[model samples]
Target: MSTPVRSSPLALTVLALLHYRPLHPYGVQRLIKEWGKEQVVNVGQRASLYRTIDRLSAAGLIAVRQTERGSQYPERTVYELTAAGRDTARAWVREMLAVPKREFPEFPAALSNLLLLPREEMVEVLGERAEALDRELAGLDASLRAEGERGLPRVTMLEAEYLRAVTAAEAAWVRSVVDDLRTGRLTWTEEALRAFGDAGT
Candidate 1:
């Protein structure tokens, strides 16, 4: 028996692209950027993309259709989705849509440790974060507006829309926290922290 192929964002994307047509690794990377999937999928490193492709091939989800050679470029192997791959892709989409997995992101982790910093430093840092998030939210709005103006279907850009919503929410939340911190509504002193920890004992 073969080990199950782990489903990662990149692996799932590889399967989905192969479902449309056979493509080489370079083609996959090109389409990802052109289609604006890079925001949600982490394929900034070519090596990681190649690794995911190799794993999918090994798992029997995808098969090589042919290899092409050109004078100016290195030989490229084109891959197509197998029957198993098509089924797996659909299953993954359903699972992803139906379930929300617990994920640990850096921002939350940092928020957990914010007490380690002095109040003034925390205010300064969080204020900076609010500014940065505002910038990010602006970029997402611009992208969404540009694509909408181009007459792209909303369905095709659902991920971007979701990201924009999430960014806007986080920006608003961060700004609120900064305001509270500045107003001394949300803050902790070292003695208070020590006493709180002792109370837990």
Candidate 2:
């Protein structure tokens, strides 16, 4: 009995993109950018993307088909997900949907450090963060809703809907934290503060 290999997030993302259609690396980068227009992925991280693609290829999840483009840049390697890759992508999607999400640390860390800050200053900082999150959530929600209204393909609309849900959940969590801070419901003791600092060091 062999243990199954887990896919990296980037690998899964690449596979998902390729599952939609075959594309060169540049096309993949462009599609990702278009999908996340408001919050662009730095496609400058080509090395990292290609490395994940290589890993996926080795795993038989994707295949490279080469096309010679006359002179300038040799043959371009366009990637397409294999049958295995499609299955893997579907499995990844199911796994992601099934798993309970863990809380991300950045928000908790900021909250923990707030006790060391002046009350007014802490409130101001948290307020700013909350506002930013709200704005982002609003943008994501609008985009998803608009995409939905336009009757985009099922997978594309589903992806946008998933993003919107996640963003909304995060925004709600942020609002709750801000409310706690505003209402003095949350606090940190000195010992806990010391422990946090020690753990960081």
Per-residue error for 123 in candidate 2, Å, reads 0.3
Which pairs, if any, clash in model 2? none
Highest TM-score: which candidate? 1
For each candidate, give its TM-score against the true structure.
0.95, 0.72
Off by over 4 Å in 2: 1-5, 37-44, 71-74, 101-104, 153-155, 169-201
> lDDT by residue for model 1 over 1-201, one digit each (tens)?
334789989999999989999999999999999888998999999999999998899888999999999999999999999999999999999999999989999999999998888878888998898889888888888888888899999998999989988988888898888889889899667799899899999
* Candidate 2, residue 73: lDDT: 73
Give residue 197's error in model 1 in angstroms. 1.5
Highest lDDT, which number? 1
Q: Which ten residues in a row have the lowest lDDT in candidate 2?
A: 35-44
